[model samples]
Target: MDVTSDEVEMETAPVSADELVEAMRQAADDAGFDLEPEQLEVARRLGSLAVGEASVPAHLYLWGAAGRGKTWLLDAYFQALPTERKRRVHFHSFFRALHRSIHEHRTAAAEAARATGEPGAGARAAAGAVANAVDRAVEDLLDEVDLVLFDEFHVHDPGDGTLMIRLLEALFSRDVSLITSSNYPPSGLLPDPVYHHIFEPGIAVIEANMTVVELAGDTDHRRSSAVQRRQGFSRGTWMLTGQEADDELADLGLPRPDAADAVTMAISGHEFRASAARGGVLWFTSAELLERPTSVGDYLAWAAEYDRWVLDALPAPEHLTREARARFVHLIDALCDLDVELHVIAATDRETFMTAETLGRGGFARDAFRTRSRLALLRTVG
Candidate 1:
């Protein structure tokens, strides 16, 4: 849970948002994607801002329902920007890196205090190191970047509340133009009534500095008959018993490991038994994935090593323990972000599998819609 994978900030050329949208239409014409009017209008506005033809606050925060093309619009805009000093990072990856960097910085400072000594991820350290560590983390992430785009931005974890505000302060202070794609608006982040206050300051920063845009729509057009491709996660299967998935696995030369010979695997720093394991392939029961104190960082670590993941005996979320159910939702988010395969053998039908939530007052309901939308990228069979 200590390490997470992130897209390295890219070094590339820039174009205008409107031009990028035109290119998208041309390339994806086969999918009948004309570039929705709502998104196009947003693109023009972004282009205007890029050219100084329009003035907004500090940046943009595009949010609304899942499948509303918030990400698509942001991605296109990223490619179209006029400066080469832009970087795009998945927020979770940045978060993990920031955490690791902070710990390292803190430990170093504490060690300096040791002889002066230090406190670290693997070492002993001091409390004054915390503030200095955060400062260093912000500097490391921002560097010379003039613009940054953070995808899937949300604040569900109260632990991230203060960190989020601090990071935002650094970005705004450095005049880093920001764009984010999220299912939640600034007000909706960290929606748990108990924890929402923790993020209120960060929310205020977002509301004050970013132009909030809503891109609402019905229907996930990506799952339309014309667009869904047979690739990546789509190459995976969801079925009753995983028989079809097994055959495909074997046919592709990575046969599933037998349950009797469960394989012990190391994720980040923890050890757990997989239902089976082979070359870049791993199998697990839903319990194996969800029942423990595993985190999204752990999921990402394994994903970096394995190309395929098979999850069996996936029960209804309502039937799972609160912690277990939350892990499942996090697992989905992690997998969706990676270029890996997920073959699910559900204990219930897809309807129930998709709709079920952990029985609780506060959980991952906010993430469910995004989870289902991304899961649609994969092919499902009854």
Candidate 2:
């Protein structure tokens, strides 16, 4: 991923982060959005830092309320950058892949050691194996990318929080530049005060490694944009959980899922049972979709095939486990990304759904925030 000097010069010549952001402001205005002063300030700072040609580029942590254009700004900066060794990814997907790679390496090493019939791969040896595996995995995962742009970064699970420290340390060691957008500030991450200390190391690393820019605008750009450009996303419903939900289904000419005739789909040679399937429409319960250890890959596969999805009985996150909440976020993200016509039936109404107790708790906030932000674009009918 070579950063051609000519290209760099063209983008960074004299244009500062401030200037670039101002340009973005004008563009937004042209698109009927009045950019806030705070957004412009943050963008200016980001633009200036982004032009550095140092070996280890300065990193940035952009944080603010949801829908303040943090992602929009970072996206513009990412595209304008002259480097070919850049990757922009959703934080959840990136970490999932990271964990998967580490697990694969560690498991393979352990299996190989066991198969070799060698004695004394004891606890200490196992620890060493894990460390070595992590090193290799980090290297492999970041082999070519010099700049990684993570959208909606947050840590809730202790395992993920702990891993963040290691990941930050590893990335710093390799001099990899990072640009992440989040709804939390450096001090505000992992906001559960009881578990906040668990991520101290990661937080410290972030503070030392990146410049923090807070985008504290009052308006949510996505919500406003949705209202202004509220087309394309249509045929959605916010229905009641039981009888009314069934009635809505009937109104839409959808059949009730039969227990005796469950529909199943296969992905990667593994069978995944669905509540119901008809034509290209699929039905799933919140429990089946979120309670299971489903990956984004599963949703991606389904999204590719299904034109319509009916997610029924979404229990407000209180009853859901942490993993379930995370999966729900991933599910919504996948469907939104694929632009699937989504019809949902929940115990609660749309107003209360986004700010549910579970969504506001722990690291789920960022994902929930993003889910809600994207949901704003969706057309809703009661």
Candidate 3:
């Protein structure tokens, strides 16, 4: 196949690791995300090696606690890149695309077998067709881009486990660079013991080939704005009786309560439904919060949609394990970074919510939790 001029240029253009690192720093600064010196150094090294025609490392695994700006930095790096040479995709979205491609191929193969009158050939033909479809999808993904940036690299489904290993092998063979960010270390992913070995080869490849950089720092940039809000904040405690709060919310142009009793608002092109739970609290789900990029832009969009947020229940620390807790903190940081104000009306005391047993037992280091907890308090108050 004749590669496009753009692809040729990507294949030949020399990308400086240091320059890319500097660009990332500038981008972070532009986005108001503070980067530590060591983090910048690690990014510089990765940038230096991330591009080039040599048989570079097959995979680069960037793992850290949430709210450390891993995704932001990676995105900054990706966006600053000459667009023709890179592709950035969330794992879930990519997998869904891949799944659709697989299904299409299977359907085509079954039709071909039927037209040929090949008795009992549909199953085998479809299987081969699916494999070929996956291979082609992988090829196309690599063909146009030298570097693949996968955000939120996670393996919840066993089927995806097999696909990921295969996909990485193919990309490595093609000399395409893979950069991924995840909440879990490579070794700790896909924790089901039975399927753990499926991920081992990919993990080993990443460890040997790419530099594993940890973004260690104190500030949760996501919460910075919320902290600022709390620093110079004062709000009267106004009790809105159920009817009064409802009427006030309605007057503010929020959705009228549905027959099913859900208050729905559109935020950043996504719909979020909040329902009054016990003790007059409102609840938002993780699925709702993570449906789109939780960037500053998105947060501003959300602010226009709803005047006030009432979280009857924040994500309980117990609801998440250590890895999950870190991820949530990162999300909260993103929300804070966007200046999304939160108001919680809970039956439980603030201390009880802040110091839940789940919070204590989760494997987060004390210092990290302390920093995050302070931010959480600020967000709740706002």
Q: Which candidate number would show the highest lDDT if scored against the true structure?
A: 1
In model 1, where do residues sit more than 4 Å from their true spots?
1-31, 51-57, 114-125, 223-227, 242-245, 252-254, 259-261, 357-364
Model 1 scores a C-alpha lDDT of: 0.70
Q: Model 2 misses residue 18 by how many Å?
A: 6.2
Model 1 lDDT tens row, 35-123: 67776676666665553223432588888888777777776666545455666776766777766777677777666765732335223
Candidate 2 per-residue lDDT, tens place, 1-382, comes to 1111111223224455556666666666766767567877776776677433676678888988877888777766666665566667655545655555656666766676677677754333455665665576567656666677777787767877877887778877876777888888888888777899999989999999888888887787766765554332235556767776787778777767779757766765467678888788888887887786677767766766777888878887677787887787777766664457778888877657767664554636556666777777655555
For residues 199-236, what per-residue lDDT tens digits would candidate 3 score against the true structure? 88877766776667777777655445443334211121
Model 2: weakest 10-residue lDDT segment is: 1-10
RMSD to truth, every model: 4.0, 5.3, 8.8
Q: Score every model by TM-score.
A: 0.85, 0.76, 0.62
Backbone-clash count (model 2): 4
lDDT (Cα, 0-100) at 96 in candidate 1: 70
Better by TM-score, candidate 3 or 1 = 1
Q: Global lDDT of each model?
A: 0.70, 0.70, 0.57
Which pairs clash in the backbone of model 2?
17-44, 17-47, 17-48, 18-44
Model 1: per-residue Cα lDDT at residue 146: 64
Tell me the lDDT of model 2 at 335: 68
